[model samples]
Target chain A: MIAITIQQGRLFDPANQLDVITDLHINHGRIIAIGEAPADFTASKVIDAKDMLVIPGLIDLSTRLGEPGLEHFTTIARETKAAVAGGITSLCAMPDTDPVNDTFAVTELIQRRARQAETAYVLPVGALTKGLKGEALSEMVAMHREGCVAFSQANQPVVNTQTLFNAFDYAATHKLLVMMRPIDAYLGKDGVAHRGAISSALGLPDIPSAAETLALARLLLLAEETGVRLHLSQISTARAVEMIHDAQARGLPVTADVAIHNLHLTEFDVADFASFMHVQPPLRSQRDRDALRAGVKAGVISAICSDHTPLMHDDKLLPFPESVPGISGLESLLPLLLALVREHILTLEQAIKAVTHQPASLLGINRGSLQVGAPADIAIVDLETDWLFNRRQLMSAGDNTPFHKWPFTGKVHTTLFQGRVVHQPKLA
Target chain B: MFGYPGLSSPSLQLNEAGKLKHLLTLEGLKPHHIQDILDRADGFINTDTRQIHKQPLLKGKTIVNLFFEASTRTRTTFEIAEKSLGADVINLNVATSATKKGESLLDTIYNLEAMQADMFVVRHAKSGAAHFFAHHVAPHVHVLNAGDGRHAHPTQALLDAYTIRHFKGADFSQLRVAIVGDILHSRVARSQIQVLNLLETEEIRLVGPKTLLPHDASAMGAHCFTDIEAGLKDVDVVITLRMQNERMSSARLPSEQEYFETYGITEERLKLAMPDAIVMHPGPINRGVEIASTVADGPQSVILDQVTFGIAVRMSVMAGIMQT
Candidate 1:
């Protein structure tokens, strides 16, 4: 492979607080030199990155790449391609796959598939329990050795207190990062949308804020007692944000991420009972949305994720409640986050950190940085390009997104994975 | 804060001219909209009482009763309403329809539309099912929600409004109305509140156990009361809801007897209301669970009247949409 040099672009590397105009040299799939390069360095290929903002590749904390089971909805190759196009160079593939990734073999299968796809890095998260039934714990140690970045029950809540305690105990011993999507199973029972005036009027069964807060409080305490490294995913309520902040202030080894949709949308978005707006730990009130944004600003919420669960078209064609929960989020993730910066809710640096260094640091991964000798994972973004989001233009199989036809002001121009150009816009 | 205007149902339910295109929910309905439906229903009430007659207003139209969920009363009333208006009516038991044969709801809708149906009366167990139909149906066609899960039952609200206007007078601003029992699972209660609020009613109270009340029940322009007596105090009307049996299995209520003992509208509880107060129920009454036999059978009980008004209100709604 020829060495590549990216020239004269404004760079923003959140990991080291480096923001300046610079040139980067890459060789052997690593960033060989930045700024003043070695005298012997010569680039065989050059990428003119003028008029772009180069940053460390975005890292999503959670994503659903339906592979090894749900190939009809999505596959690792398709989803990772979409992810890279949206500026995500790496993502934690949720363990809630078919024949759940609770064992070393399943984790290894994901690794092999991601390698074969050559789209982007896939960090397989091992299931916290066998079959994710909340019964016996999975072989965490063995799965971790096989390259599972973290362990989670995915969207399913662990109903048994003892089961959760046991899993936390084991994870604590191993110093493993246990990611959880906190929800009180009973409180959210069969509920389709947020409990509010809108839900009441729409007559949809509602999942209340209490459901998230109560479950989050319990999990926070459990993490406190177990001394486990907890990374909470996709928290939706204001109270949940407050709880996570207080826990972190008390020095508990806990970090949390809010989904991008939660910050940009709310229960009002689901007012017409649009099936695309349906999501687990359902879209909440406006107050909660503002609080979540504040949490992100205060640095209490360390990252923002796609929570990118995709579904087939028919899956959303049924009645709202009967439809599956999730949004096809990967393709829209970057534009939506950039929208926050455009709207002045977040600064450019803050938005970059939320997707890059913050999430990478939470997972204890060293990839979301622009350090010399680091893997050349990078994204060049056009900060002021306006585009329309249409599902037909998406790479993933799932065309189910609430943001269809939404006008966005920022976009990813090109992405590189391990020094290889994986996704770039086609010439007009 | 989540009050994004585009998130509401009115935009989907009404046309650009603010006319009802589809009756999805009673929310966002103006005072005149409710008055127009009630006045049209009043004319029907007079005609039905005066003579055996049929109107040719909807004579050329074809109405389809697309019931995905069973509701003998709602379906029968809609059928009667369509037939009385002289429209051809078809009742489909969608439980055994092409939907069960692996057909999607939109596909089923398209097939019926191909048959030249002009209107659809949709009843589904999921909330927003009717709204879904309205969005996908042909622009010339209209949708009327018989009931959709815990969402609005607009015709039920209209009839309740008609029943109140017929007995207690058209002005609801000075009227105090109390809706008792299972407010959480009652689409009737949700729709009723929307209508009552639009009418600018003086007070609307929701009475139920905390477990059976929606979290934001008070936000629907009703005061929430745990005690039946407190909610019924000097109110001019009472609307009781059927205790949904399915909710009991989910443990929302302890037992039918237990629910009746705590929240049921007995004669003793009725005395707490005003002397001329009327009683209403959108029934197949759970005789013991939601109300006592004497109260349900009493002179003040307009429960049967609500059923009568249901047909007229549904007819008025269908006629209104066709006119649009």
Candidate 2:
């Protein structure tokens, strides 16, 4: 492997509490040194990162690469490429694929495809139940051995409380992390948006905050009883954040993440019936969005994820309620985080940490840092450049972002994965 | 042109020139635009001759009645309006169409557009279905929303307004109108509120059980009252909404008998309003559930007039959009 030297960059690694202008040396796909190279070091290549911000590559907690099942909408290869372009070096691929990631074969298949793509690292979240039917248990312990990062139901709820309890108890016994997007299936049934004045006026079916708070209460209690390491995915409501805050304060092993979209958008975004704004655990109220931002600031919400579920153009061309939910979020993640910084919703360091270090810590990964021994997964960003987000710039197969045409500051100038230049867009 | 109060995107119902391209919702429509529609409806029905003269306003235009929901009354009124305007009409009950066979909505729309559909009277189960159709249809094609989930029924509101105009005069400033029952689920109430507000109706009271009312009922520009008698008191107009049997199963209400005992419109309750005050309903009324049979069939009831005016109101909307 060629030795690479990234010279004169402002490095920002929140995990290491390092923010300084320095040179980073990478040899044999690992960060060999920082500030100064060794006497014998001879760089095969050099990257001039002058007037740029170098940070650890983002680690997304939840991203759906629609391969092995819904590849027609998007593929693992396409999404990973898009993720890399967004400076996301590792993506925790969801388990809601065809032949659901309940088996070793499916888990292995996803990893193999991701490897072939040679982009971001794909961490498989094994399904909590067989076929994601929520009725029978899957081989969590066995799948964990096959490199499943954690187990999740991935939007499907285990309707039977006994089945859910047993699954939690089993996961706890095996010491596997269980990720749940808490929503009471009955309460949120047939709902397409948040229950609020806007949804009521628009006449869209509404999912109440009680659906999340009630379900979160159940999960918190189950996590307490079973002693399971619980991670709540896509916490949307203020009450849910309050519950998680209380849970963490009480010393129940629980962590939560809010999607990047929820931090910025609210139910008002869906008022025009723009199908792109239709997302599951649907874009909540402005108060809820503010609460989530506060949750991120207060550290009750430890990480922010893309919650990137890409769908075909036709999938979103229907009516709001009938349209498929989710945003093709990888490319928008960095810019939107930068937006928070610009708006003073979060400090730059806090924004970067939520994506990189915080998510990495939540997943128990050794990456998302620029320490000497760590893999050279880094993003060189031009913080001063402003660009309009458009479909022509979208690398993902799904052009389903609501942020299209939005003005965004901060652009990824270059991305390095394992010390190799994976994505370096030419200056326009 | 006034921007729609709650719509996040620019109203698709209007063109760049601010002309009526589609009649999707009344939320963004100006009072003059509404007055123009009501005025056009009056021209269709000659008061002196007591006849609804069929106009050739949409002589060669082809209108498609694309109903995804089952609504015999709404569809029939739209069909009559389309035919009355001398336009060829095709009724596509999508429940029995290619949609049931798994075809996408756009695919269905494209297929209809290919057949040269000039206008579509869309009644869909989903709230934004009409807007969805309006967005995807050909530039020349106009969309008229008959009803969508619990969103808006602009034509129904227009016809209801027309009925009120005929009996109570066009001046809505003095009208203390009471809209009783199911404000949460009634698309009619949503559109009625907007139309009433646009026409500057004084004191629009929403009377319903707390469970049947939207959480932000007051934000919808109406005084919400749980007490039906208090809501009906000295009101110039009473609009009773149907209490669906489905609400009973959904735990919204205990029983029909209990609902009738509390919120149901009766002759006794009718006395609380002005003696000559009119009663209206977007019917297929649940005879004894939301109203007593006597009140529904009484001289004060303009339930049948709403249906008659609905045809004219729809004809006016169809002609208005096509001419634009």
Which structure among the candidates has the greatest lDDT?
2
DockQ of each: 0.59, 0.58
TM-score of 2: 0.97
Which pairs in model 1 have colliding backbones? A203-B150, A203-B151
Q: Where does candidate 2 stray beyond 4 Å?
A: B1-10, B48-50, B100-103
True contacts kept of 1: 0.65
Tens-place lDDT digits, model 1, residues A1-428:
66888898788898888888889888889999889778988898888888889988889988989887997657899899989988899999999899899999999999999999998999999999999999999999999999998999997889899999999999999989999988887886878889887787677888888988888988998998899899998999998888888888888878999899999988888887788999887888999999999999999999999988878777888778888889888888889988898899999888889999889888888888998988899999887788899988988778889999999987888899999889888999
Q: What's model 2's overall lDDT?
A: 0.89
Q: For residues A148-219, write the lDDT of model 2, one tens digit per residue.
A: 989999998889999999999999998899999998979968899898878777777889999999899999
Candidate 2: clashing pairs of residues: none
Query: Residue A411 deviation, candidate 2, in Å?
Result: 0.9
**Ten consecutive residues with minimal summed lDDT in candidate 1 chain A?**
A197-206
Regions of candidate 1 where Cα sits further than 4 Å from its true position: B1-4, B47-52, B96-103
